[model samples]
Target: MAKFFQKNKTIHDENKLEIVSDKSPFAYVEAYKTLRTNMNFLSRNSQYKKLLLTSSIPGEGKSSVSINLARVLAENGKRVLLIDCDMRKPMLHRYLRAQRFRSRGLSTVLSGNSTLEESIATFSDLQFDLMTAGPIPPNPTELLASAEMGNLLELLETRYDYIICDTPPVSLVTDAAILSEYCDGVLLVVRQKYATFQQVKRAKQNLQNVHAQILGCVLNQYDVSKNVRESAGSAYYHYQYGDTKLASDGMMQ
Candidate 1:
């Protein structure tokens, strides 16, 4: 069985910022192989030049996962763009402390109130571009379902090696599901213990009903101890099966 990782949540002094520099031994490398494997799989199959990272409900850590995954992909030499598509309550900008970019983003561009070039904001230091949700619109879902929204993603696909969108939770609103069809693939983030199996199953079905290609799931905030025990059980089950099969063959001989 593959070993599970032990990660302790860091307590940063009031700044409320998560310092996840690649220098931290566990920051990028420990999770690099796992993230890279997922990225490679998406890159090869699904024709997924663009991806949407969303959850069944809020507080599932979809934004953080999208950011880290984009960073990992950039580290692997892929040109990645992470867009904040949660207009109702935009937090990606706050997460990264990027305030200037939010003024002109997806809502601005999609509403025909701003040009695509004017709407996008780049972070050269991060090596990944970001498009914020922009000024909260009166109707976010309707705007996202519009043709302009589709054109914008198509335009981004031509410009970036990988386009990752951090959208609003599907179960909370239909925004994510509406945007799912526009994306090349959808990656669902399931919160450990918080997100129920039924919630994930329903989210998958929702994506399927929309004909969105679900890339798979990323189980966030997973407990290392519990996962290890579960993995050990699976290994034991497989080992027992193998031994029984071998014994049966020997008896037949």
Candidate 2:
């Protein structure tokens, strides 16, 4: 994995904006690879392909995790398709620096205005494709829950090894839960010191209400300086797979 990295490059292009996961430090990328490995193990015996990633609220780095996870899978030679289903605040295109193609994404395809084949933006360098949250629609929730979206995912599943979706915060809107029904499983993100126990509890409730299979939780944005002090002053990123059980403190542990 180290040999394949693009050395000396930072994980962000400018203003800590655009994604550079491929260029991230070995530890950062390794953390994501760990996530990829755990996910593979969890679904090894099952045909779980369409996975939805969501947090309890916005700004928890759910989108970031989704993008990096997809990239890691692609790096391993999987045909991965990442979709920005977070219509309310779609940022995958911006993060990927593929904004020019965001106008023809998930929303547009679900509205009967475009085809998935034509809407996706291919990132040749990353070896993965993306479907942005096309022109935030008037009713993101409705569009996602509609039959069209379900059919679209089914069709896409046949063409890709993984369909990783980044949806609106589960507690913010019903979109994540609505889309969850179509996914093989759901990965909830918990940003340390940010996401509250109450919020995550509710988010889990939302997912459970729709009978979405909870694969596990991702512990994101762990402060390496405070605890894992050795990574001070560097681009430190920590990702942990919490126990399958959802703890009362508002995270999976």
Candidate 3:
């Protein structure tokens, strides 16, 4: 398991979203570099490459995290494929600016309306392939849990070194927990001031109930200045692995 904190100040602009790249802020880039290193260590130790990222609720930034994580991994020369598994609310295309292929993606492939190769969109700028959520489906849960979805993943694993799936919030629906069965690990994204402690706890419990391998949690949109002001002394956060206790404030101890 791996645990890390990321603080991003970039505001989401629907017309032009920002992702990690050479032109990004130094601190933002370095944070994702650290995340990449941590995930690499976990991958080597656990022998898993398929990772699923979900949050306790909407607006937690899991999709953005997934996109940047895949971008960083691809920057390291790995063959990465980022999939938009949130069929009900697909936004990867919009984030990556590949909305042109929004109509033909994972849903179309799983439903036999399109082939995987035909649905995949390649972003030359990002250097990784993307499979959008496709057109919104009536039964997203069923489509994700279908045998075809499993087979598609199996085929993709053979082609790519890493597969990052962005799923819906765990607390809002069972989609994340259900898709966890096909993934090797799960990363929970928690927005600092937005998501409640109880909501996070319930999300973790939901994944655990499905026996999902929780790689770790990412604290998103963390405000370093606010924490420094509140603590009056320390500006750093800490986390402990295995047997770690969750403090009442929802921090790992």
Candidate 4:
């Protein structure tokens, strides 16, 4: 059984937590701390409960962020549920290697054919739960925007401390924008060196148009390598923090 995340945990920087490996237990601890700090900031605006993790486009590591964020929340003595709301391209289940579960998950619940409780798969520790995108529906946007989706989220609000939805990229599909309406907050993940300014602007606009609480953007896969080019096509990735020069993309802002 997986152990539950305790409160006030801390981890060192540079420790990466792998979903499939039992190694890096300390990395998990550290990852939990980093995510918990982010969660604290997120809670300031939308409460610490329901959140949607989306990106401007696909293959941007948003699913990875969602998985780790939920695990961190679970570690903090909060019952966390990570829902794979990206019906078109469900990756949360694959990343978590979540066993003891079946497919036909959120799609079923959203279509009113099943209940949220029936689809939720509890982890070994009971602190972390997972709900996969069961069958891919033809019209994911319609299902996500329906009243049943709202009802399911409302039910989760009363039970879990955190409900994280891993939805499709906003620029790739309307699924994220649709699901964001039911969530309290939306965290957009923008990959460094990949996502364009136009796509990000459109994504932010899409969420804002729906009145979704934009919790701020997360710059994933941040690299400080001297050889790497900046998102704006600059060769230099250094920033002057006080007198010391820091080699990081300005995405941290």
Candidate 5:
């Protein structure tokens, strides 16, 4: 069974508590912190603080990375707000084990059903905030692409240090590409052994077509044993877009 995430016995859902502060071992804690550190250099200006995290396809651990990154940021004393923009398949609420699910999220705020204050749920203990997917709506794409979404993001930048959003897959839906317009940059999460280079390349092109800034990529669940021995101790190819190349063990470097 996978360690980071597993299916819950009763809920039949998969949610992992691999956060650094409350749980996680030394390497996991240090890994998320290092990811936070690299992200710190993204921008000195808080105005440009929105970072959208997405993946090429489902089951690639984008939501996992987003929540973990948010936790690490909050641990560093930053007021982080993680919004589950993947209204179709919201998992942030599941990850937090929220008591219930209702119209208390981006959808409600976008549709004027509720105020932003009411939509946001504060993780009192975790020190970060979360905006769930709210009630599943029929027109998810329209709501995500509307001017209301842009306005909400702009308003959030004033209140949160970082607005990290977990969105739907780029190839699967237009939501990720559409939401990318409001974000400062987009981070692609690629699960090693699952996502192919071509799929990630297409995802990047999709983001680029939308004019979203490419922050880099996060290679998750990367096992170095097989490839490491094969390469005889060589640096992993972290990211290769066109001519640019930057490699790290796991976090975006």
Candidate 6:
């Protein structure tokens, strides 16, 4: 519901990356809170703890959305654990500025090289814990679809109020669809002007093929300038709930 503009940079730009923090802009922070509220509303009647975030393609701001969504949930006093499942191009560690702890993460724990406790990185400032995509494995898809991945989710579900996984684009890899089986619901992140209609349609079909519960879609990097009279200079992220019909009709514009 809040609006703001990001100047001269996309959400994926490392130099001008936008993240929700205590010091973040009021509009930016409020936007994520709104998203969290919608998510809670959608899952009020169901147990939707383990959530997976993916996109139709790369650079759609799915990782950023995953991080901010997890943060907002944690801020609401929920026990949250964010995992970087995008091992092929893991960016959560860099986004969190916790590169030092990335040496041991989900990959390490799943591969039996490290214990779960040792791989999870805890931040003093954050209410939630994080699991970076530890050294990229040669078999990302295989590792994710392994029994260990399901076991890991089962264990974490007992310990945390929410376990949010940031997985690769659905159209690009089977990782998202594979992990969606272990999740309660899947939220697709669609970036404005970046994703094509066919791409989103294909992404949706891929998830459907696996029977992944598609909760909704988050419209990222939306150009608010066209919609809001005062928001003429910048673009902002918007969240939307994509029903079955909406998704089937290609939600991207």
Candidate 2 wrong stretches, greater than 4 Å:
1-22, 224-253
Candidate 6, poorest ten consecutive residues by summed lDDT: 244-253
Query: What is the per-residue lDDT of model 1 for residues 180-227, given as tens digits with 9 covering 90 to 100?
Result: 889988889776676678988888888888888887787665556554
> What tens digits encode model 5's per-residue C-alpha lDDT throughout 1-253?
0012223311223343344454344555666777888888656643458999988866677776787789889989999998989878676776677636455788888999988777777766666888889988999999998999999988999988899989988987899999998899888988776767898889989998989998888877656555432211111222223354433223221
**Candidate 2 lDDT (Cα, 0 to 1):** 0.74
Q: How large an RMSD does model 1 have? A: 13.3
Model 6: CA > 4 A from native: 1-15, 225-253
Higher-ranked by lDDT: 1 or 5: 5
lDDT of candidate model 3 versus the reference? 0.76
TM-score of each: 0.79, 0.84, 0.83, 0.75, 0.82, 0.83
Q: Give the Cα lDDT of each candidate.
A: 0.67, 0.74, 0.76, 0.67, 0.73, 0.77
Instruction: State the lDDT of candidate 2 residue by residue for 1-253, as single tens digits.
Output: 0011223333454324323344455556667788889878876889889999998876566776787788789988999999889787676766666667766888889888887678887777677888889898999999999999899999998899999999877887798999998899999988888778999999999999889999988887555545543321122222222232222121111
What is the TM-score of candidate 2? 0.84
State the weakest 10-residue window (summed lDDT) of model 1. Answer: 231-240
Q: Model 4 scores what on Cα lDDT?
A: 0.67
**Superposing all C-alpha atoms, what RMSD in Å does each candidate have to the true structure?**
13.3, 7.2, 9.2, 9.7, 8.5, 8.1
Measured by C-alpha RMSD in angstroms, how accurate is candidate 4? 9.7
Reference-based lDDT, residue 136, model 1:
88
Say what the RMSD of model 6 is: 8.1
Model 6 per-residue lDDT at 247? 16
Q: Per-residue error at 20 for model 2, in Å?
A: 5.8
